[model samples]
Structure formats: structure tokens, C-alpha cells
Target: MGSVEIIFHGAAGTVTGSCFEVRANNKTVLIDCGMFQGTRSLEALNHEQLPFDPKAISAVILTHAHLDHSGRLPYLTAQGCHAQIWMTAPTADIIEPLLLDSAKLQAADAARRNRRPDRMALPPFIPLYTGDDVTSCIGQIKETCYGAWNELGNDDGFRLWDAQHIVGSASVELKLADQRILFSGDIGGGSAIQCADVPLGGYDQIICETTYGDRTREPVLISDRREQLAQYIEEALGKNGNVLIPAFAVERTQIVLEDLVALFESKRLKPFNVFVDSPLAERVTRTTQRHRLTGYDLFSVPNIRFTHDVEESKQINSMSGVIIIAGSGMCQGGRIRHHLLHNLPNARARVLLVGYQVAGTLGAVLRDGARNVRISGHDVPVRADVKIIDSYSVHADRPALMQWIKDRGPVSGSVFLVHGEQHALSVFAQDIRKAGLAPHVVVPMLGESWSVSANHAAKRICPAREDLQVRIAPRDWTASLAALKSGLADRLRALPSDAARERVLASMTRALEDAESIRTIT
Candidate 1:
């Protein structure tokens, strides 16, 4: 029988595009099929040839419904990954609309670039799959609830625990043979406006994300932030300011709507006719209504005025003082761009940013207090008041995350960090050292794997690992592998007696005692 291996198919040194593969019992399973986002060179890596074939996968275990974690499923399934897709009920409901819209967005991007799918060098740019592909992908999904353990293949099993990032998000615990490897999907803040609790751990190899790992996102009293946002809108509305909020299509859109509704009801802000201007965002809100009957009860908020038609969306801008929440939070694309193009150059407008703005995005420029921003084809003056609130983000910041980790089960394994900026990861690495968790803070690179085994499962493989796939043909690899494989095999055979066998076994145990697995390549 063969041993298990966890391969980093995505979300390596750089964040986003989060795909990881676990191969055991000669069956392959994927965790989180997400897309990579960023600069052209970085994004191009998503389209680059994969080290492994897509069709060989047996199943996909989704962590959440966020586009970054679920976006690439359509493309992979289109390429013939005919395995059962497993996720929480809400995640399954969410994947459908999100992927269909992402496909539409890709097609839109291709059309604007005036290029055929065949001409784009971007990964999955080969038409970026179709709406049909998304439909096919959705049809294969099976739902599993949090806190349940399900067997996937052979004796391999996993427990999907609450991650609390969004509705239906989960952190996975995978059991391979006798070994336990925990893949901590994006951990969430304990106190998001919506959702609850992070995962507890008893992991041998903990693959954790650090999106906000550098420093704690200091506490911002929710009431204070909400009041600040309400006052910003009220002041802007008094001046006839068009409040343009670049909101995420998922939870953020609903939060803004509910928050605004409360403000209006409380007489904190005048009822100035708010507009939710993205069709994609509208669909997500509709889907979120289903969650109201379950664990996600935030969608039932009254007085949310969503505009589904383009004409109605355009009419929102015609009105002088209106609140517009649109998708593409970075103001990179989608309905948000159209709103920004029309309102950002005006003196009587305010932009409320309540999400992370990656570098180079229009939102980032505004956050940096830039004097002007280029929108569509013209340079627009940035006369609008730009406001940011951390209370709105769903993920836990560093301090909150540390609290969860502190309360989790014993840290008997190596802590392998994933999903954060390099500098931010470096800072967290230093912080963890101060927190006193050991077995080394391993900063894993893209495509690097470290072998982990439970204390009871640790054993010496006599044949040595051969026929292992190499991403690139390694020089001197054949000679080194041959020598090691031969030497290890010879050592096993040369143990001539029970006494010698005991000696070998004792040495092996001693070696494993101090020999924690840690491989970090930048």
C-alpha cells in the first residue's frame, strides 16, 4: 500500500487560488478549488499547466463559498473532474450563483479585451468555462453539516468543523490511515456581525491561513463604527452626497443594507432611497434569505431596497442623494465601477469601504488618500470622502485569531502557515514565537509538502519513495534517490535478529521524537 501525500496545487507562497490535493489509497481528493487574483504575472500562474491532471480527482471538499475558494470549480469540473463536491448546505446554495456570475464576468472581461478565449494566456482563460459548466458543477454537489465526520475514500475520513467566516464555512480534519492532518480552511473572527466560533485543534500538520496575520485588527466598537457610518451617510445626504459603497456581493452587501435600514428606522439618517446596484449581489441576497430559516438569520432584515434591472440601477444615479452598494469591492469592475465613474469625481459624494483593498486596486488608491483615480478611460478627481471600517470584514484579525488558537486543543504538531502576505506572515511568525508554540513555524511555499504522521502511525518505509512526480526534472535526483532508496532497503534487510530489530525500532522512535516535519520554501 502507498502512503498519503498532500500536494499544494494552489495558494502557495502567494494568497488566493486555494487548491490543495490529498492523495491516499490511490485516490485523489481536492480541498477548496479557488481562483488566484492579482497582477498579470501572478494571475497567470492560475492558467499555467498544473503539476497534476484535473480529471484524476475523486472529490472536492469546499471550505466556504467565497469566490477565492470556490471560483475555479467550474473550470476543473469542465475538464472532467466528475467527483462528488461536498460542502455545507449554505455553501452549496451559494456556489451556484457565484460561479455563474464569475463565468459571466470572465466572458465580459474577454469581450472588453476584444479577444477570443483562445487568445488569452490567462489560466482557465480558455473560455473560463461556461454557464453550462457552472450548472454541471452545481449538479454534483452533496451537502454535509458542520461538526459531522464523513468518510470519503477507503479508511480516510474528515470532520468539517465551524470556521465562522461566512454561512456554511468549515475547517477540515482529515484522517489518512492512522495519521491526522488538519487543514484549517480560512479561520474566521469569533465575533463577525453574522456567524460564530473558530475551529479547535488536535492536529499533526495544521495548514492555517493568515490573511490578517501581521497584526491584530484592533477592536472597533461595532456601535461606534456603525454610528460613524450612519453619520457619514447623514452628513453626505444633507450635502446631497451620493454615498457609493463598494461592497462585496456576499455578506457585506446584506450587512450594509441591514445597517442602513436600522439607521433609517432609528431616525439617525433620513430615508434617502438606498440602491443595491449589482445583479450578482441581488441574487446572493435572495439566496441568503434561505439561510434565515437556518443558522444565518441576518438576511431577514426589512426595508432592503434592491434594484435588479439596469434601468433602475441607472436611475439610482439620477437621484442626487442615494446610497449605492455594488459589487467588485476594490472598485475594480462590476456595477461598483460604473457607480464610481459617475460619483467619485463629484464633490458631493462619499465612498464607504468596509473590506480589504488589495494593493493596486482603486479602493486601495482611495484608502491611501490619492488626489485622483483613473476610472474607465479618464482621470477622475477624488473629491469624495473615503471612509474605512474594520468591523465590516468577516475574517478575524490577528489578535482575535490568537485568542481562538489559545483556546484550541493542545498544539502537538508543527504549525504550517498559509494564506497571507509574505510580510504579514513574517510578522505573525515572529508573534507566534513570542506566544510560545513550537515544532517551528513553517512557512510553506507553493508546491512544497511535509510528511506528517501521528505518534502511533509513524513508521519507516522500507522501499523508499520512488516514481514520485517531479514538477520539473531534478538533476542528480536519480542518483540521490537511488542511493537513499537502496540504503534504506538494505538497512531493513540487514536487521538480522529480533535484538537488531528492537535496536532499529528504538532508533526510529527516537528519530521521530525530535523529528517534526517542516518544509518551507519561498
Candidate 2:
């Protein structure tokens, strides 16, 4: 039996990026090459040089089409990776649009930044990768079936199992000589109406995700969730205002549409004009409809209108008492931000969040009831009601995750937990030890590595990257800066006299000067 080594390249202490490198029998393969998301400091890592050489990788196994798991594929191809990328057919279909949209967004953002007057003298910003890179990467992808084992050269192979997280999501089982290891791509909770339950199996070693390992959610039935949505929409419309839903263009948007259709068909919801304002969401919805998995077209409903152009999307802001669904579930970018800028200060409007928001994102800020937010460099007051439906989260909760782990049980070697915050993974590790679910459990840090053998415990080799330790914090300086700006503004406005406001501003200016002096002296 050949020895196997695994490296934790991403998604170790933080929840967003999801890359891993596996080496066996003089061959190397990458499990995923996801992008780092959330805070600006974290996203900045996306432009840094990859720790490993892309040309050395033999093949890449993609688990799904989500940006966090597949965003860096184009970047890899741009860096000279020529290996065949393997994924399920559905993933292949969805990623083409997702990656292309991502490229466009990046290009647009770079152009916007470069256009700033302050940035005119600085080096022009460039996108991480272009549309051409995405096309090149897509050309290398080969579709594979769920149950069949495909050879990876040198007598090694892998098989795919349904992860049920999203359309075409899969958990991979890798076979190398006498050893087998499994990678649990994001597992789906039982809330998805179109996906089946996750399948289970045993392996010598397992690498699992702990996205929601610290908490167990209350069970929410489909009917109950739909009723909750109906209530929120009705209440918002009753106040003579529109409802804005910022959703992910992939599974979350489709799920919301399906529930909306169900509510209308059951006469639980009144027919209101609903605008699907995101072009990417529209494309994804069309693709889903083509699959015919839901037995009916979700976009065929008479009340739902898809806006195909920028002018049509802009028209949505002028309408009242209607429902608008947009992309970028986290409120990071896209048409949702424009809608938020327009409606956040409207006392009668409502913002409904339907997915997990990373800790440093604008969505998290609004979900936590921030009264003022900065969107597109403009400060906006939060007069609209912001609500969240936790039941809509696609990730499995603690109980479901534990149950899935137990089902994949009798693991003879070790279980490595990744893709979660530090606290979540730590608590999960403690629980795993209490239940004796595996012989060994590891909560790996970013840049750490382990060697696996059939009869021995997994051995740690690579040390964690000290530089990355700061990047794992839930909130970074960007969030802090925003809060500071908002707080300063509010305090200045609340002062009883103009002199008081001037005094506060003068004090802040003096502090900044003193800090600058200290830096110069040091």
C-alpha cells in the first residue's frame, strides 16, 4: 500500500474557501480550489500566489458549483494547470454561467476601482482571472456518473456520492491502493425540496465539513416555512411597501421560487407582482427549469416577472407593494446592493435574508440590526425591517452533521474537520470524542498537512501558517471601520450643539495626528 498525504490549503479555520491537496504514489491531485470570501482582508488572499504549483496537479475533483468551492478554478487554469477536471454533469452545466458571471463581476469591480479619482495615479487594478480563463478551465472539465469509479492513473480511482447540498453536489470517495479516503463536500440539510437525502458509506479516513457543527436548529417543515414566508410578505405589503429578498442565484433562489409557487397554488398567498431582478438568477432558473427535476417550470408563474436588462432592474425601485428577488445572498455585490441603497431608508420596506451570512459581510451587519450601513460608498440609514429565516439555511445543523458522521462510521483511521469557524470545529471535535465516533479526530489549521497510512494514526507534518491566523477572525478591520464611521456620524448628529459636534471631530482629528506621529517616530 502506498502512503497518502493531505494538505489543508483552505477552509480550515474559516468557513469560505474549500481547497485541499492530496498526494499519493508520486501523483498529486486537488480536491477543490475555492476562493477566499468575506472580509476584504480575507478576499485579498485570492490574489496571493498559491502555495502549490498548479502544473504539478494531475487532476482536480470538483465537489459542486458554488463559488467558494469552484471560484479559483479559472485562476488555476490561468496559472498553467492543464489537468482534466472532473465533476457531475449538472455541476458542469451550472458552473459555466456561475464562473462567467463571477469573471464579469470581478472585471466590473476592478474597472470601478480604477475609475476612482484617488486611484488614477495608482497602478490599474486587474481582475483575478478573465472570461477567457474561465472558458479555458471549462474546456478541461469531464462529466462523471455518481456510482461509477473512474481511474486516476496509477491504479487509483474515485467515486461520487450525492451530497444533496445543491444541484450536482457530491461527496468523493477516493481509492488508492489498499486505502480509501472520503471527502464530505458540503452536506445538505433536509430542507431542500428538490434534492434527495445524503447517502452514507464507511472509509479508512474522512475529511468532513463542520459549517454548522456548534448548533442544532429546530426542525422546520416545508409547509411551516412557506407559511412564514407568506406572513412576512403579507405584512410587508400591507404596510404599502415592497419586499426585497437577497438570495443566492443557485439553490436558494430556486427553493424560494418553489415555495412561492406552492403558496400561491394552495391559496395561502395573494398574487402580487414579483420581480426577479438578477440576470444571473434568471439564467440559473432557466437552467433548472430545463432539468425538469421539479416536474414544472418555476418561472412560468404569471406573477413572477424576470427583468432581462439594467433598465428593467432599475425600474423595480420605482414600483411599490411588490416583491423583488436579487442575487448575492450575502449582500456583498450585485443588484441587491442597488436595491438596498434605494429601500434601506424606506420605513415601510422589508429586507428578507434567506441564507447564511458570513460574519464580516453586509448581510450579517443588517441581520444583526445595524441601523446604518455603507453600500457602494454611500451611507444608508436602516429604516426598513430586516428579517432572517434560519430554516432556509442549506447547511446541515449539528445534529444532522453528527448523524451523518455516525452513519459514515467505523472509520478506522482519522477524521479531519474543515470548512468551519474555529469555535464550531472545536466544539464539534469535543462532541466527536465524547461519542467515540472515530479513533482519531483532527481540527486542522490552514496550511497544515497530515500523512495517512492504513494501520497507523494520521501524522501531522506541515505547521500552520502563522500569517493566516489573523485572517480567521470573525470580524476584521473593514467591519470595524464601518462601525466606527457610522458611530461617529450618529454621535455627531446627536450632540446637543454644533460646538459639541465640532469638539468631538477636533478630538478625533488630534487622536489621528498623534497616532501618525507615533508611527513616524517608531
Candidate 3:
């Protein structure tokens, strides 16, 4: 019997980048080719050499259109990977605008950085992938449907099941020889809309995402979430301030629109200027409307303004008592930054966070209650009311994740966790073990590989790379601590007193000595 080997390339430890490779006989397949995001250290991995030759990949199965899952397609194409990309029809439609917008953002960021005259001379800035690369990647896409088996060459095949994370998200079932492996791309158990059904009791091995594995979310009723949103809008509008929502262009935007519409239709919210600011989000919203016509709507709201031109987007800043929904969900970039710049200092303004914010992202900084945050080289005061509603997230929580696994019956082979932080993975792994849901549970590190046979036996043939050990290491608390210390030192140095300088030095020495003591004990 032939053997099937699966490799964890990214998203094995951290939550952002996601890539997995499966090989059987002489053919190879890739599950996802997402880009690294969040911290600069992690984002640098996007420019690092890919672990395997992309050209050798025979095909790729995309689970959804999220950047964290499909952002690197253009980069892969640029690197000479000519694999046939497969996804649902909606994913195909949504990814087109998302990728092109990503390219534009990258180019814009590079241009902005190079314009600083005080900057030291460096190599010319280049985007990760150009517009042509995105076109090339789109040309290779082949659409598929839910519940249909498609061949992956060499007698291995896969079936896509709706993952319910987004409009076209899916979970994959790969059949190799006598063994069946299921990949849970991203599970959306607590979403506002109805998620696709979860398949049960058919696979030998399962790879799952644990984005919310460690935390149990409060069961948020959709009506309650909508009511809360209405209250926030009313409060902001009463002060003649605008309400800004930095949302994902995909499902998040659609769902929020639906909620807003429901509130308006129910007469719970007053009629106001609702602007869909991101051009990409506008296109996505249109696509979602078409899908909704086919009985796949979250909630449809009418009388919203869709702004695409730069002048129109700029005009939004001058408007009052408006509700604006824009992209760059984490506030790392995009039009959301411009809105934040204009509204953050306005005490009457409200910023509603409706998605998961990665650590080190501007969204996280705001969510963590930073009194002052740097934006476009300016320190913006956090005067606006910031509100976060947990129900808006698309990922499954810990209880839902565990129940999903349990409902899938017993896995004869093993369970592997990905797409989560170290703490979430650790907690979920323990939960799985304590529940005895699988014979073996592995929290894979990046570059790790496992070989599985038809008889349900699996062996680890390769360990993770030592150089990329940080990819699997526990969340870098040291980095955060160092940043805090550095910021404090800078503030102390600006105190214009020798006593302040001495205090900085004294604090630094104490921290270093404590670190040394911990290191010695470890």
C-alpha cells in the first residue's frame, strides 16, 4: 500500500499564516497559501524562502477567501508555482478584489515609507506581489462545489464541505488509499448566520483550527448584539459624532450590514448615513447580495451608500452622525486608518471593533486600551468610545470546537491542531486528551511532517526546523516586555533630569538581573 505524508508549513503555532502540504506517491497538494501577518517578526516570514518548492505543488484547495488563508496565492504564482487552484464559486469571486486590493495596499505602503527624507538609503521597496501576479494567480483558479469529490491526481482525492466561516468557506476531506483525513479550515460555530453542516464519523485523521480554543465565549444572542449596536449608534449620534466600524470586507461586512438593516427595519435604529467605505467591501457586498438572492443571505439592509472614489471616501470625514463600515479589519492599514485618524480624538465618536484583532496590530492596541497610539507617525489620543462585541466573530469557541470534534465520532488515527496561539493550542490539546476524543493529539510546529499508512498508523518522520523554532515557541512575552521597557526608558530620558535618567538605568538593571535569574533557573 502507498503512504500519505502531511506537512505543516505555517499556522502550526501562531494564528496568522496558514499552509499545509500533503503528498502521496509522486503527487503533491497544498491546502492553503496564506500570508503572515501581525508582528513585524512574523510578517518577515512572508519574504523568507518557502519551505518547499512551490513549483512542485500539483494542485491547491483553498478553503476560503480570508487573507490569513488565501493571501499568498499571488506570491506563490510569482514564485513559479503553477498549481490549479480550487474553491467554491463565491470564494473565486471574493478573492479577486481582495488580492488586487492587497497588492495596492502593499505598493502604497512601500511608496509612503520611501518618501521619508530622513530615512537612511536602502534598497528600493517592492511589494510582495504585483497586480500582474494577482492576475496570473486568478487565471489558474478552477471552481468546485460543496459535497462533491474532486480528483487530486495519483488516486488521491478531496471533497469540500461548507466550513461556515464565511460565504464560501469549507472543510476538506482528503481520501488517500484507505485513510481519510479531514481538514477543518476555519470553523464558525458562533456566527450570526447558519453555518454549513459538520460531517461526522467518516475520517481517520482530522486537522482542526483552534483560534478560540482556550476561551469560552458568552453565548451572544443575535438580537442582543444588534440591540447593543443600535444603542452605541444612538449614543454616538446623540453627540453628533460618527460611528466607525473597521470590518473585514468579506462576511463580517455583510453580517454587520444585515444586523444594521434589521435594527432599522425594526425601527430600533434611526435612519442615518450608512457608508460602505472600502471599494473592495462594496464589491464583496454586491457579490453577497447575489448569493443572498439564491437563499444564502445573512441579513439584507437597504438604503446604504456605497463609496468607491477617493473623493467620496474623503468626504465621509466631513460628515456627521454617519455610520461607516470599512476594511482592514485589524486596523493595520486601509481606509480604516484614515477614519481612525479623523475620529479617534473626537470624544463623541465611537469605534466599534467587530472582529478578532491579532496581537501587535493597531486594533489590538486600541482594544487593549492604549491612551495614545501612533498612527501615520502621529500620536493620536484615544478619546473616542471603543466597543467590542464578541458575537460578531466567525470562529468557533473552545466548547464548540470540542463538541464539533466529539460529534465527529472517534478518530482512529490522530488529531492535529493549527491556526491558534500557543496557549490556545496547549489548552485545546489538553482538552482533547482529557476527553479521550482521539488516539493521539499533536500540536504541530512549523515544518513538521507526519507519515500515515492505511492501517491507521502514523509516524513522525521529521521534526520542526530549529531556526523557525519561534514559530512554535510560546507567545513572545519577552518581546512585549522589552517594548514596554524601551518605551519607559525613552519617556524617562525626556524628563530633563539626571534623577530621571538614574531611575531609568536603575529599573533597566533590575529587569536585567531578574531576567538573568530566570534564565539561570530555566
Candidate 4:
């Protein structure tokens, strides 16, 4: 038997692209073949060469249907990965339309860019994959119910638990070479469905997400979320303006729809026109309705319409007193951008952002209070009332994450933290150490590999490049530096002789000046 090894291919130092490879017993298994998202630099990584051969992989286990976690499967399929893609039934049903829509977007973008008159004289843009590739990838998917164990290869087995981050999301538990390793796939909070009391302990080693490792959210209840949403809808309607919500197709759209349904069903709000603008979100919403658990029919809301044609979508822009939920949650593409272009400059309109917007996305720009934004080759002024309710976030906050890890009863091995920014990863690693929860906690970088033995001892085989190491202090660097300066000043004042104090202060000033004058390259 060979040593069980894990290689981090993505989501090591950022919040997206979550692929990992586990090798043992002469067989290899992949977990979550997600795509790199957000910044242009990160998106470029999507076109880079994959680290491992696709054909060599035995199987793939998917955690959910979100594009960042499942977007690259078609590319992998195009590259000849014939391994059975495993996921829950809901995920399997939803991923098809999502991936196909992704391909359509890619092809459309390339075409649009090629048509530009000022385009650089470069090679014609080619999409990463086509609609056919999405078909091929969907054909390989095999569904399994949650909590059922499935054998992957000799002496290797895995199971999935409800992660509650979204519908059908899961946390994987794998047994390989006599050791158990748990992979936390974007855990949600206590209020999420089927995850209120998720099992967090009892694994030899844990590979966990730290997406919210450095922050906490306000204590906002579901009632608060619904109340606020109702107020926004009423206020917009009163002004004879529409409400635009740029939502993720899979989970966020469903959640918002459910809340809206509940509000009208309870007679708290009058029935009004609600349009689902994106075809992808509409399809996913229908699939979600079919996959609804017993007695949980959320699609029967009043005054709701699903617009699938371009003309139908265009009609919504001129309508007032309507609620439009559309996708490309980050406002980077899709029908949401069109809706934003129309409504953002209308002073009476309202735009509510519900999901996390990464740094460079249009959603982030709007959230940061940019008065003018470029959309579809035009600059549009932001005259609408934009509100962000972060309480709707699905990812668990820092305290929740710590509690989740601590609930894992007495892990004997180290914790490998992934899926967070450098700041969050560094802060969370130190927090784990200070709490004495683990003997060692590592925030791995891209392409780093580690070996785990049958006894659960782990050793890193490849270190991150020296330049990529996040060397910031655990406490805020500015605060820590200021505290050090204050302590040094006090100690200098305590010196027995004025001459000695003056000498030390002068030396410190010179050192500070020298530090300031030094130039460093990133």
C-alpha cells in the first residue's frame, strides 16, 4: 500500500475553486472540481494546465451545485475524465442547466469580444468548453443519498452529511488506509435547513473551510430578514419603482423566494408581481421545487412569474411595482446586469444585495458606493436606494466555525484550513493554536501536497513558495506595531539616565527612517 496523500489544487489561499486530490491504495479520488473565480488573475488560472491527469482519477465527489464548486466539471470531461461524478440527487438535477448556462455565457462572451472594433489583434477567443461538454459531464453523474457510504476503491470508502450551506450541500467523510479524514464543504449556520445540529467531531484529520474566519455577523433572525425585505418591497412599490435583486440561481434565489412566499402567505404583504428573470435561475427553481422534501412546497407563492424568453425579460424593465430576482449574483453577467442598468439610475427604484460580492465584481463595486458604473458598454449612475443585508449569508461566521471545529471531539491530528483569504487563514490558524484545539494548523498554498499515514500523522511534502507565505501578524499588524511602539516608549522613559533614554530614542528614530526609506518589491 502506498502512503495516503492529499494535494491542494485550488481554494488553498482564496475563497473559490475547491479541488483536492486524495491518493491511496494505488487509486486516486478527487473532491470538488471547482473553478477559480473573482479577480482576473484568479480567473486566468482556470485556463492554466491542470496539475494531474484527468483520466487517472478514479472518481469525483461533489458537495453542491454552486458554479464555483462544480463549474470545471465540463472542462474536466472535455479533458477525458470518465470517472463517475457523484453527488446528491438535487445537485445532479441542478448542475446540468447551470453548466450549460455557463458554457452559453462563455461562448457568448467570446463572440461579443471578437466583434469589438478596438479588440487587440490576438488569437480568436475560444470557450473553455461547449454545450456538448456539459452534456458529457452530466452523463457521468451518479446520485447517492445523504448518509449512505459508498466504496471508491480498495480499502477506501466515503459518505456525505448535510452541509446546509445550500440545498443538497454536504460535508464528506472519507476512510482511507485505516484513517478517517473529514472534508468540510462550505458549512452553513445553525438556521440552515437540515444542518442545525450537524456532526462536527470524530475525525482523525479535518480539512475545513475558513471563509468567514476573520469576521462575525450581527445577530439577525429570519423574522428580521423577512421584515426588512417586506419594507423594501413596499417602499419601492410606493414610489412606483421596481425592486431588483441580483441573486445566485441555486440557493439564494430559492431562499429569497421562500421568504417572499411566506410573507404573502401570512398576509403581512399584499400580492404583487414577482418575476424570475434569468432562464438558468428559473430552471433551477423548478428543479428545486421538484426536489422539495416532504410537505415543503415553496413554489406555490402567489403572483409569481418565470420569464424564459428575451422579450419576456425585456418587458419587466418597463414595469413598476414588481420584484425581479435574477442571476449572476455578483452582477458580472446575466439578466441581473440588464436589470441593474435600467433600475440603478431610477431614483425611486431599490436594489437589494443578498450574497457575498468578491472584491472585483460589479456587485462589490455597487456595494462600495460607486455612483457611476459601466455596464454593457455604458456608464450608468446609481440613483437607487441600495441596501445590503449581510445577515442572509449562508457561510458560518468565525465563532460558528470555531464552535464547529471544537465540537469535533478530540481530533488527534492537525487541521488543514482552506477556502479563505490570507488574512482570514492567518488569523484563524493562530486562533486554533491559542485555543489549543490542535497541535498544528496549516494554511496551505496552491499546489502544496501532504501525506497522511494510517495512524493519522500528517507531513507536508511540498512547501508553499517563499514569496507566497502570508507573514502578517495574527493581531492586526498596525495595532500590533503601535502597541510595540507604545511599550518601547514607556520603557525608554523608565531608563535610569536621561542620556541613555535620548540615545535609545535617537537610535529608534534612525531605524524607523531607514525602514521607511527601504523599497520592497511585491
For each of the candidates, the C-alpha root-mean-square deviation to the true structure, in angstroms, is 17.6, 2.6, 4.4, 10.3
The CA lDDT of each predicted structure is 0.71, 0.88, 0.84, 0.82
lDDT of 2 by residue, 1-522 (tens): 867999999999989889999998777889989988888788878989999999999989999999989999999988989999999998888999999999998998898879887678999988999999999999999999787779987779888887878888898888876678999999996532222353455678999999999999999998999999999999999998989999999989988988998888889888888898878888888887665478448667999888888899998888999999997999988889999999999999999999988878899899999999887667789999998888888899898988888888888889999999888999999999999999999988889999988756899998998988787677888778878876677778889999999998899899999999999999
Question: Residue 494 deviation, candidate 4, in Å?
Answer: 54
**What TM-score would each prediction reach against the true structure?**
0.79, 0.95, 0.89, 0.84
Provide the lDDT at 118 for model 2: 61
Candidates by TM-score, descending order: 2, 3, 4, 1
Stretches off by above 4 angstroms in model 3 are 190-199, 293-303, 454-457, 471-522
Q: In candidate 4, list every pair of residues with a backbone clash.
A: 201-408
1 against 4, candidate with superior TM-score: 4
Order of the predicted models by lDDT, top scorer first: 2, 3, 4, 1
Could you say which candidate leads in TM-score? Answer: 2
Give the best candidate by lDDT: 2
Give the range of the ten consecutive residues with the poorest summed lDDT in model 2. Answer: 191-200
Error of 3 at 137 (Å): 1.0
How big is the positional error of residue 96 in model 1, measured in Å on the Cα after superposition?
Answer: 0.5
